[model samples]
Target chain A: MMQMADRIKLKVLDPGLLTTVQDSGRWGYQAFGVSPGGVMDEYAAELTNLLVGNPPDAALLEITLKGPTLRFEEEGWVALGGADCGATLDGKPVPNWSAFYGRAGSTLILGFVREGCRAYLTCAGGFDVPLVMGSRSTYLRAKIGGFQGRPLQEGDVLEGINLVEARDEPGKIVESIRPERDSDLPLTQSSTITLPPSLIPRYGSPILLRVLLGPQEDMFEPEGVETFFNSPYRISHEADRMGYRLEGPKINHRGKADIVSDALAKGAIQVPGHGMPIVMMADHQTTGGYPKLGTVILADQYLLAQGKPGDEVLFFPCTEEEAIVAWKERRDHLSLVRAYVDRLWRKYA
Target chain B: MSVSENPSVRFLAMGEACVVVEFGNTIDPEVNERVHRLARCLQNLLSRPEATTYQGTFYRQEYRSWSEVARAGIRELVPTYRSLAVYFDPLEVKRQALEAQITQLLQEIDVPEPAGALEAEAGSQREKTFPRQGKTVIIPVCYGGEYGPDLAFVAQHTGLSEEEVVKIHTSRTYRVYMLGFLPGFPYLGGMDERIATPRLETPRTRIPAGSVGIAGTQTGFYPMESPGGWRIIGRTPIKAFDPFSDTPFLLFPGDFVQFKSIGEGEYRKIEESGGRP
Candidate 1:
């Protein structure tokens, strides 16, 4: 029913390591054994969407480690967030956590990640993938949703939907917001709109993740709990979207390690008989049999998601009240940024 | 409905976002029914609009409206064997507020007696009173030979003939406790102890979908091709999970299932006719 010309499109020249389409998540269906598959870093994904003047829940390309080579078929506003992926447009360097206007036929190439594990890319209209079970996220194991329910391959074309036509000239918004540009200089090319340095998230190794212990923390012995908190674990190479298996101290259980299978919360640290804790992630199953030691707080989960394989992870125990407060602070920070971005868009566009 | 005098419930925090309301430790039908019932009640309450005032016994003046609670972001409710995990957004609702609401709902539920105990009291009344009233799903399974490589092993372990094993397996109705492990893979209860067998010491890397397998006292069929430890005694032609269909899952918690033994020729016929037996 929609005209092809009205929608902007992007073609994958070379699909990077594990590029997939993701949105907020496929919610309200976990009880039916469905995984809440979404972007690993929700904060980054939301910021990327906001940068492009799109809704926070818009479907965006989630690039893992290596990035993709995509060619814009039409002129569109695009933004990069999360990791510093060393992206370049037509061989010209593009800064991270910034928005820029890509001309039609311009090839955007993303090199290996200079920092962080995953990166997010979004256009002004968002990807036009058919929503499966009320989500556009790609749950690779189930092969549902997103661009054909799997990782993007070479030659896969993606269309941008719900384009908001700017009232002013294209690239004029970026020109007006240019902090360092002189007032006398004429705006010929589209300038980049970068977030303030204080607003950008800093990714680092040996990430300290604060956890709210329990749901099944009593299953572990006092010594096991002590070991869990005392020792630093390295992210195993076996890590993927499903979970990150940590290798460090073998946390012993007081009795049997297995419990009658129960529902798994997001960021649950499940410890099996082997004693190694597996931090369940975006694509974790609805339920698991192993006893959980603790769950990483929602606010710190972004740092955990950005953690690379072999990265050191230190867990700190926090109370439920503290966890709630941390989440509120994160939400307040995002709201501030959203308001700032909306004001900028209103003045320039 | 007459509410239970005092049902033992524990509110365990899964994280800041979720609270696991555990009914009991064991996988009894009564406890599982309560889990499903609570899930249904919460779902019904959440679906209602914001303006409607709830006049329940558990309503407290300090708590906000039902729709405000809903707006506070009750994202998902997952019902398991003895517990229901309620996942909500901590940014919108505090952990204590969500737990208090769930505790209130738990107090309102009428805990049914054990199935055996209720059956003796009033047979006709039991049917009407039961929480799950859905029709039993009959799964046609072809036992032995090439379809089930572990059939002989199961029979040998149980000290029963292969035919006797099949007969006992199909004799009783099984309760679908929950769907987990794999998508639409029902964790079935009510298997005959005579046919009980431990899982394979070395788990097979690739078990075909529709394989009816038993591990310990539990029996279930794989919905998708996945590596499993459950000893396969038979294979079913029916698709346990059809992702393409409007109803993706074939089973849900509190549903009933019955196995019907069929010959290999019938299995082939059903498989050829798109799993409609």
Candidate 2:
């Protein structure tokens, strides 16, 4: 375990909405019924960690819907990422994606965001938190992680280490910084894949996430499958971290519903007796009942996660190879981006 | 390329980090059996010297370079589930050999149930082979007070007096069907048919922890404060679980729980004394 320096007793004074500490996530224990819990927005969480010089997967505080009033007992640097929560520090404005040099005994207050549900606060050297299993992410339902696996409320102290020399400005890494920042926002998410055109999905946009039929996919009739791909569905208000309930024309399996309980996946769109398909999410249980018509590709989970209720989402059938090809292309593009960013940082300077 | 009976079993790449070979679509015994077996097979297929295997044989492989082994490395066992997802960092896990190695293992292990028995007998035989950690704790409950405003209502539904309701409730042993919906909340099974009830039309936003409730042929304890619709007959002083503690839950899958009768005054003493079950 790594001990962080300059530990600050973060008295919440008040925890607004849901304030919990998070990290990349916990994996490899779903058989025990443990949800792979962590930061809902992993891309933002990692970026914030890297900005503060912590390894990308380091643990951080995830402020939900609203932020908390935090008072630092010691001075340190913290990077705020994910959601544009109208953030301001000490009654003045603090920018997102930039590190703030906070002084000792100062109060940091955060407010609500118009677009996203969560905002990440990454301390200088990551939070000095013990990990359960092989991760440090907070599993709220199991109540095991993040300042003891519970939401931060009034009078909670969050601790972290200072391993990085505080950064000066955005630095020469400014190459494409504006575009990168814009991409991180809600508006710029292209309906089409953003990588090299050659790496583009064979399917047409709006992308219909094709799953190579689930084991239970046969339970549904052929028309059920056809309606699934052609028809449009709206996300319901009953959605949360666990899963999203789609509201639309109730899907039918041989014109009947009520499937024998079966296995399910996050993104497995289940057509319950109501015929309305419920798409499972990160916090979905290890097993489930209901006929799962299809699943969203693992690659497009982030896209699905960002979508709010009432957004119209359509499904397009895809081959298993197409899904694998998309994943390989994504990884390759990510590497290219990382390399380009690193070289630009040095060359421009 | 092949399909099996477990309908929802599919490989879902959570992200860049890991892949899950999930089994089942619901809380049925057959689905659960396949899920556990697949998990166990994965543990055996991906054997690493550094991994620390725990009870139930859950193992975590520690790789200095996660990306290499992660590629095709995770598809070690096709074990009768729907499918298994493969995830790894291609930039980090540069070796093509890792994927081939796991694919080789996948083909070698086809009999699915390493614990023994054939694929068809997953439900009945698998549980006997696997050793599940079980606990039996007697919880002291005070019924039919303000803590249990619905106690009389439950009695009326079951066509029994409040006193008789207590007697019947205390007599049977309840199996914790599962621990879900909330942390440590017990989804119990095996309630007497006479006492079965449907949930309320409207749900209470905040049901206190330890609120013993009856809903649809099952009696459960609300291990945490959450919205609920069960008919609450009483409350218990037991903490039920504390995640910070080593053993997070006071109960487990095969645990047997009994409710001992108590009164408001006795309940107060137990609460003030801080006695644990």
Q: Against the unseen true structure, what C-alpha lDDT does each candidate score?
A: 0.81, 0.60
Candidate 1: residue A160 lDDT (0-100): 77
User: How many Å off is the CA of A25 in candidate 1?
Assistant: 1.1
Q: If candidate 1 were superposed on the true structure by all CA atoms, what would the RMSD be?
A: 5.6
Q: Give the worst 10-residue stretch by lDDT in candidate 1 chain A.
A: A178-187
lDDT of 2 by residue, A4-121 (tens): 3444345567787887777767665443345666776555566566554456677888776788788777766567766667766667666665555566666778898555566778
Q: Give per-residue CA lDDT, model 2, range B219-264, as digits (tens).
A: 9888777788999999988777654555556775445687899888
Pick by lDDT: which candidate is best? 1
| Clash-forming residue pairs, model 1 | none
Predicted model with the maximum DockQ: 1
Please give, for residues A128-166, the per-residue lDDT of candidate 1 as tens digits.
899888889998887888999899999999987744443
| Residue B120 Cα positional deviation in candidate 2, in Å, after optimal superposition | 27
Candidate 1 displacement at residue A249 in angstroms: 3.2
lDDT by residue (B1-277, candidate 1, tens digit) is 1113355778888888888888887879988888888776676566644213433323434224544786668888899999899888877776666766666656544544435654554433322322334348999999988778999999999999999999999999998888877778888899999999999999999999999999999999988888889999999999877766767777767688999999988898988987744
Residue-level error in angstroms, candidate 2, position B137:
4.7
